[model samples]
Target: MKTETGTPILWTAADAAAATNGRLPARLPAESSRAEWQATGVSIDSRTVQPGDLFVALRGPNFDGHAFVADALAKGAVAALVSAVPAGLPADAPLLLVEDTLAGLEDLGRVARLNFRGKVIAVTGSVGKTGTKEALKQCLEALGPTYATAGSFNNHWGVPLSLARLPADHAFGIFELGMNHAGEIAALTRMVKPDVAIITTVEAVHLEFFANVEGIADAKAEIFEGMTTAGTAVLNRDNPHFGRLLAAARTQGLGQVWSFGRHDQADARLLDCSLHATSSLVTADIRGERVTYTLSLPGQHHVMNSLGVLLCVKAAGGDVAVAARQFSQIQPIKGRGLRKRVPLTKGSLTLIDESYNASPVAMAAAAAVLGKADPGAGGRRIAVLGDMRELGVQSPSLHAGLAEPLRLAGTDLVYCCGPNMKHLFDRLPAALRGRWTESSAELAPLVAAAVRAGDVVMVKGSAGSRMSLVVEALLALDQSSRAGSAVAALSGS
Candidate 1:
């Protein structure tokens, strides 16, 4: 939100001094001393620190951000908020000595929320939280000035950082809260205290931290921990855990419980949804109101989550009709459903990049999208997949379970990577098996070689699997091809 145009004044040096009770440098560094001195931006990573921004030095187990205080100052950071000063820092480096930078960030976030007189929405789930948050951001932006969490900043550190960046004039704020264990969502929700809370869907994700899927559901239900007294809880009724989630919300004294999904009983229900290669046409009944919209993002999962988004728009007193139309403009996010046309010899190759993160439910959903896409005349639908980590002892079964979705998708070839994926590769028919490798880096070349003109390829895996390397390699191949074409054109060939 720290642009030249928008209101980005979260705090100034004087303001931060008052907020944290810290002291400024006795001597001003003449270069940027007169550069407004506003803490217009907040960044933890010194690498991304901008001029005149406040850098919070956060200490972690591996690398302490305080170690980079000098680096941040050199990168044009106007001030530093730190618990401890690093050796060799200049005497003129502006500083805010807080007891703990994490706690300080949370304090600033609370201050931002206290002053924000807008609809605050919190989104969480085992899957689709990023997609839902992004689509909802577009919807709310269409309705009014909106501020949403950047990317999937939905963790212990990310949530507070996002909240602290919120401008006071924002009409809407969307926070994505993610967790891998119990009590994580509870704590984040307490900080968010959303006016509209959305639990996208509870699944067998992060089962390594819980005893069972029900335990995961219980942890997801903790999103209601800090709901506003009159807030609404939006859920996916089609999910089996809907009953339990509803009960939990009711127990929290939430009066308005709107469920969005394929179930006919859902308050915000999908009446009909037609999934296309890169988009979907959806008709839904939202709070007894019938509506239809075209969603630019593919897959039924997005359609279901869009219903929840539209309902949340209405709950937040936004223009549901206008917000619903915004769906058509919502494009796929990078490493989620980002689609690209990679230049090839005969034609162009279609690449669907779901390399950011994955779970069983998400993988099945992506595969379904592949099933629906036409591979064109001579092209084949190829899935370049990798491991879905953190499924606990059920990792093998879960990996093997993807075979059915792949088979049903009519996938012409499958190139899998990672140790857990070996189980899936073993289950695949010989004709369907493209190749298998112990790591994605090793499989990247094989996948690149298998891709042909007009082929549709999808790459997906968890962060641990590093499937993004494959995505990058493919993109680079396309770029090199483009350069070659430019050279040919220059030679009049």
Candidate 2:
């Protein structure tokens, strides 16, 4: 997708140096003007650098990108952005020096955003930020060209990097903003200045850094800091802090505010929803119009999140009908409700990969999706959950509370990892407690052994717990099984 304006060609060596405040070791050759350069793209990673790209050497926590400057240059980076010139770089190489490469990259991104003329949508929440953002991208892409943050790139560096990467001719832009502390979203949102801001929902996430849920809500509200004066603010009417968040939007002088949920007054209200084995049929009242559609993805939480996307698309000057029809193409992202098939001796199995990240609220939602999963024949519902991190003193209670939902959802088996998850394990009925381990690595083997044909296995956990490793191990077994079959075929031949 192209940005609304043609990509601004800031290709002159002089312009690059000016962007970084004359931080270059030497001015670019006088003859090298914008007309002489043609950039295919830009990148911060040396490994992914393409020919004629500008490489940004940022210093990360564990590794310094400056170390890869030579490799990037050798791989065809036309220029480099660094805090200092490399030890032995040629004098003729284009080098833009700055006080901090990361900051300079952000500044360049800001400049790029200033030149972008398309509508921008910013998404954030304690959970579902990535899923909701992807949904919005899917819907908006149907109407015209669109640009969205790649994967879960919604943090400080990620936001700027995504913005900077925005092509100059896209009709729409979608960005996801995430934060764990106060003022982080405020700073990032300012850089985005979204035309329509969506708060998926606020929950007791990252409580380790806050005194209470209200504090978390305050942090999420900071997303409005960069909203345009006439922008639209989309909030979840079902959330307890809806009024508070609404007030925050008003204080920022938002021209329009839309609510999505089952609330009667919600601008986008859920009229009826029927959960199926794989997906949900949702009928919603969008500004008083009754519209029914089936989401290709599972989970009622996803349906709820889609309402925000619908309102956002309308706010961004897109056709609601076209956007609504695009839902069929929507699929769950990796480690976030993405399903896979595993072959077993008796039959095939279904694996729901929700191992990306989790919280108490998200755990309950996932368990509900797992409970509703349909096993074709003689199959059972299974849940493999890890600790919901950052719950502060409430970690034990919150973890234990999931047992009730697990039971209510009729999950046949519950496998848990992490010390915090032990609280839930203790609370589960003995019949449902399939397995438990102190770590995901130790638990993955037991899970692989337990999963059988006709079983719907759903795996979930916080990112820090490395629950995705369990998913990887399970998939590895599937791959190995396939490899063995191929070997047998060759031997038989």
Candidate 3:
């Protein structure tokens, strides 16, 4: 039997050498202790380095992490994983020298997977990968010890970093694999070789890299490349690309596949869903077994994805009942869909933070959530939106496409920012239009000053748009005196 602990082991020099096929460079700092060379976990950024962590200095085309090796050490890093020693470091610095730091990180990840005696699950899709990955982590953790990718760490570097940090003793490991171009997921999935792979859904995200949605679907199907021979592929049967994704998975020799959705053909079928303003209660039939669970997350997309989460749990031979019960503990990830109230003077305002990445599909989902929000007696539903990037030549059309969804949501007012969103701003009716600006930086102050009591403000944008600034500015309003604030609630229509 394996033992799991929240505290990591001292990843000793010998252990790292064996895992990564690297060795400590000669140069013993006189003040360094033996433990200084042993890492408890692996980190890439100097600013986020934890005391006992091995700071992996990954070099990119723009910036070099090697430049921060000393800063990482000063932040209490146990060792620095570097391809080349930097200037001014002690002769005996806790350095695990490698031929290539990236390759070394991959090697360590491979070793971690080799030593892991637990079920490994991989999640991929156009959207909701992080949310689904998080749901699984929460579910599996309730059943037993589990590890999952942190935040949206689902890229080439993030995958290896998360895997290399996997504890030897755990019941489950969940990884989120994301890619824009083809062949990316193939390489990552092969490294993970998950026992179960899930494609949450296929959408028009990352259209900048592919010629069409089919091309994006094909690229997403690459996650099947890493499935074990006996692995199960959990798919979204309701998605338009479900047939294409299912065919791709079957071609890869994944015979056991479970289709999850509200459709009749779905193995994990939705029986019923009681939707709420802030949460949902869903009853699902998992391959003939019926179970009901309360998901604290809002949006129909999340409810649909929870079926996939339960499917993954059942596929991993876990107790579905136990896992389903854990759904209540699932909280909205910050900037993803977290709900909070900013204390105002007379009354508080509801804040829905969706200021993370966005796409056409994601924007619709966010709008749907905003629609269902039960604003206060005098409150109004407001959307603070920034540009959604990476649509290539279709950026303007896609941006303009959001107008109908906003109308359907009965948004009392709309605040638009960024050049791409101007197309949508022009299409809005004068009654619903609040303001429009070329940039979120300029729009943030105006939106912040406009928010008032009984208002539910939902902010969203692409990663490059920096709409979080608008979210920050609105949150800052909560800090001001609630009484007689500049923001006044819109008069009842």
Residues 46-127 of candidate 1: C-alpha lDDT, one tens digit per residue? 9989876789899898989999999998998878889887899866567877788888888778777887899999999999
Better of 1 and 2 by lDDT: 1
Which portions of model 2 show Cα errors greater than 4 Å? 1-14, 23-36, 483-493
* Candidate whose lDDT is highest: 3
Clashing pairs in 3: 27-91, 27-92, 28-92, 29-92, 345-482, 379-454
For candidate 2, lDDT tens digit of each residue in 222-315?
9999987899999999999999999999998888999999998999999989888678888998886677888988788999998888999888
lDDT (Cα) of model 2 = 0.86
Query: Model 1 TM-score?
Result: 0.95
TM for candidate 2 is 0.94
The TM-score values for the models, in the order shown, are 0.95, 0.94, 0.94
Candidate 3: residue 338 Cα off by (Å): 0.9
Model 3, position 483, has a per-residue lDDT of: 35
lDDT of each: 0.88, 0.86, 0.89
Clash totals in order: 0, 8, 6
- Which tens-of-lDDT digit does each residue in 318-403 have in candidate 3? 99999999999999988899998987776878999999889999999999999999888698999999999889888889999999
Superpose all Cα atoms of candidate 2 onto the true structure and report the RMSD in Å to 1 decimal: 2.7
Candidate 1 deviant stretches above 4 angstroms: 1-6, 21-36, 483-493
Error of 1 at 379 (Å): 1.0
